[model samples]
Target: MADQHRPGTLGHYVPYLLGRHLRAGAWPPEIGKRAILVLLGLLAVVYGLGFGHMLGNHDLSATLRANFLLGLYGTVFTSTLLVDFVPSYRPVQRLLPDHFPVSGRRSAELAFLLDLISLRRLLLGVFLAALACVPGQQRVALLGVALLLGATALSFGLRWLLTWGRGRRHPLVAAYAAVLALAGAWLTLAATKSLTGPLAAGLPWLVALLPLGLLAGQVAGLGPQFLNRNLVRPALDTAESQWLARLSPEWKAYLRKTWPALSMGLAFKVFLLVASSVMQAKHGSDSSRSIFYLVFLPVISFTYANNNLYGYLYSLTLNELQRLGLTSRLLVLYLRLAVPVLLLDCLLSAVLLVALFPASTWPLLGLLPLSAGVFLALGLWGSLSKAKPVYKNLDLMNMRNNASTLMNILTLATAATLYFMPWWWVRAGLAVSIMLTAVVPVRRLLSNHGPQRRQLHHRLQSM
Candidate 1:
């Protein structure tokens, strides 16, 4: 085959090539359409702000500039290391057969270049560009851009080192401890103005470039050496199946049917929780003000579960749903089950808040109503929409959506309510909202349109 990395005579047909590749398999068309909609929505927001004079504020401009720079640097740095971190791409190393017609070096290069053309890179670029449009101090913006670029390169390089080092018998625990200590010292210096002088001002910028340099060095030296290394496969265990078998019949059935989806959901939740905990531990003002972590942790974890479960439910082929003769009952079951699951999530969140922020326990409890209400609203929306889940192994699109205005509004509203209202009253209001949102929607869905039911039946009949 011709080199995949090299431009062909149809260089101008890059878009066509991409389209063909994307459409070749069982591609979820909805995901692409939704992604385009989101991009357009963000652009509209930026243009609207410009017209409304919202971006005219000096402070806003300064913030935007800083964020833009930071975003750009972060994007590039993250993108460079993406191939190493993303598991799906891990197999690329083994994909190139040793006896292939092409030279080994050329094959590796092609694989690396193809990895660079990933959807992750494209989305990162779009997001970074959007961040750049945010108004901010020009210098801060410039600095952010520079820092983002530098950090990205550095991250890529460091990731390569980490991968290489993982093969050795080094004490990773000690390395982690050292890193934590260094981070603590850096934060202390920054907070105490110990590093505020001329020396300190230039250090961060310089440090950012180190990653890029390291990545370059790795690419030059270690790239070929690592390319042909034997891929290691971890041993698999079926212990979970034994445990699942011991559960109640209903629970066992659920596990049997949805284990893969559930496992993926649980893994994603654990990752987020751990990441949030680490961030809070590092940056939180004492352990007392860890309310943000408490608020976010359970909510996100449960949201991921709900979304994933819905995805698993949808993954059942239309024929399968029909074969079971349970489509109506299942939909009803979904609506019924959503409440307790969401309530459980709310209760868990409240407990975390109480544990972390006893002083603000009353206020935190008050926020529960709001959280529950939002969850119920979203659940109903998802159910009624009955949109097929676009189950990308990596949910890049959903991640982007979570960072958007709709999510921002929810966060802001929750924050504002917590700030202004008395704890007891806010709690009361939250309770009322949850009941209204959840109950009202369920009633509406049951009463008004039986169209979804009819369609389900029609589809089954056709099959």
Candidate 2:
């Protein structure tokens, strides 16, 4: 009887031991490292600087303070995601201690709770709290504490729900993230306006208390056995299998050329197509219906430019492309990759056109070249300016640079005006602007003999 009871007692202690092992290191050394910490610190300093303006200029307005805290919470909330979603590629059994409990749900909960109380995460919360305290805003620090704990409990429950039972459903995870983003956006917008209802008043309180229910469930042995090799293996395997099975090879290869590899932009593009359809349905004959396209068309550049233009250059090493003779041949190669993406856009646009008006959509296709020229030229100019071209450097000017961003805004406004002005000559102005923008940089890249070109080639080889 004493020996039988000894097994149960030892099993209970396994969780505490696992927690101790995880807390010892698993993180700063393994995950964040020195460089990442430095980057994170710099970002925090930038946020602190921004907050300094709020304190100085606005005298800590409630709306501004709330916005600042919510943004800070978003940054800290990333840690919960990193811990739960990022799988350890190492063999599962090796991560655990020897002689751990067989029925390990309780131990798993303990280990996960300990993992959430990570030193790095706590230090970040403390750092942000310190920054918030500089302006004598104690509420910010209190909000940070609540956010960290709430996010941890939420993530823990989600991770368990995803990993438990028969198989992993990866779409549910993406859907969850999208819903959360939309909800946050709605709340942020709503917070700026007046609140009058009991629901509005109680929402924050309800959210603050929500994590308690999840935490209680976790302690009751409802969480997944994260340390269990059998469970971890199947769940991860199923997720990978489902992902590959869902996407075709052609579509997958196309995405490889794009940023935000999930094709989130494509999703947005499809959304615009639906909007176009609705506009066509409502006021198909009205001249003002063209406003729908005018407003949303420029945004396509955001999705298209990175994939077909800026990113295309790096897809092949410079040395490899040089062998193909970089002038006309490279231009052809660029078109080959770019045309399919444009064609997809055209197909979607054509569908909207057909649904709205059963006439030729041929004129609308002209907008494709205009978009291609604008974004591609920008990409080429950005690449030419940098000695060692990085993706972000070639993408756009720093968004924080008000002057460059303002110039882009003006350009978009001017182009959209030219597009919708109804006169052929006015529309021709857009084409002229695009041609002037695109031709020179493209010619320079294709010319292929200069110190700059040689330097770029050398850099590519070294990389």
Candidate 3:
């Protein structure tokens, strides 16, 4: 039995991969060491200032302590998602042999490790561990551990979501819902400090252990729950609705390739709606921090996709560009593909505003439009200036698809304050102003038929 199990154990594969990575000097496959060094340096400086400011606070209040705890959780969770999702730090993955004798749980686990081990990821792990040193914070350590475990379990569900097994009845779907609910409850309880009796003492332990148990069951016990149907197709007609069929072929094709990100964004919007409503109900409009939460509504969808517009469609758009150069046709196609999402984004933002910040509803009517313009312009700029090579695998964990990391930062930063001066005329004027600014990127793209898209798409299929 020991001999039989050895082949399926991670110990065998991890040592091999670790040896290979160390031999190869730990350089990430698609990116260079210099770039990673630059980014890590910048991040170190920023993190140093930010954590120093927070740590400087010696006498923490209950609310401030609660806020810090929540912020720590959000930071750990978001950073894990962001860092893992982007095409970074996976070196030995490409070195896997074709006939390697890996199977079942072992195969899945090996695939994960192949992607996980890299110099950048290890550095990030160190950065995350430093959160424990912050003064007056005790739970940050356990919470971080529990969060990493929960996040791993959540990835299985998220991965299944990008595949065919995404309906309500699917086991992964049910698991996803349960995990999300549990996460919400965990934060809410942490904030309210109301985990009662024995439950309160064991809650952190449960959060840490339960996810590990769930992941073990899924990986080792659940046989053949993988979703691998319809990996690639020219048109997504199988899943198309009447509304989608009405679209032109070019539009439909573009939407077909990019539908998953849009769907993911829509999924986030649903959660935000529920979470925002709950927050508003508990705190009401009286909370000074409500607007800060509500102000991010326009950006939720952009985080998934819009901010990386060109990279998201590089595979398709490259062919079009070769035929047309960087002409008005390219700009028109970009606008056409973007308009519907922008409209939908506006509608969603409007709904959230009305639900939570009802008074600001009319004033912030231009919020989504302004956000759309700003990001579209910024995304276009990044496409020209800071694009990256990405894959088209529709992996649940991989959404950016060679997106611009700079634009990602700018997108969030811009949205954080987009609705800052949330007065009717002020927002409208800003919206118009940004829309006019878009012409600059349009001229930039048109004036230069840059070959970045084509070069980037060399590794991609025509889809």
RMSD to the true structure for each prediction, in A, is 8.5, 9.9, 7.3
**Which wins on lDDT, candidate 2 or candidate 3?**
3
Per-residue CA lDDT of model 2 for 242-284, tens digit only, reads 8867975434443434433224345555655565655556666
lDDT of 1 at 363: 50
Order the candidates by lDDT, highest first. Answer: 3, 2, 1
Q: Judged by TM-score relative to the true structure, which candidate is superior, 2 or 3?
A: 3
Question: Relative to the true structure, how large is the alpha-carbon lDDT of every model?
Answer: 0.45, 0.50, 0.56
Model 1: weakest 10-residue lDDT segment is 396-405
Q: Clashing residue pairs in candidate 2, if any?
A: none
Candidate 3: RMSD over Cα atoms?
7.3
Could you give candidate 1's per-residue lDDT for residues 274-355 as a string of tens digits? 4445555666634433334334433453333343334334445344344653344454655555556556556655554455
TM-score order of candidates, top first: 3, 1, 2
Clash totals for all models, in order? Answer: 17, 0, 0
Best model per lDDT: 3
Best by TM-score: 3
Candidate 3 Cα misplacement greater than 4 A, ranges: 1-13, 19-58, 70-124, 133-140, 153-184, 216-237, 240-247, 260-331, 366-463
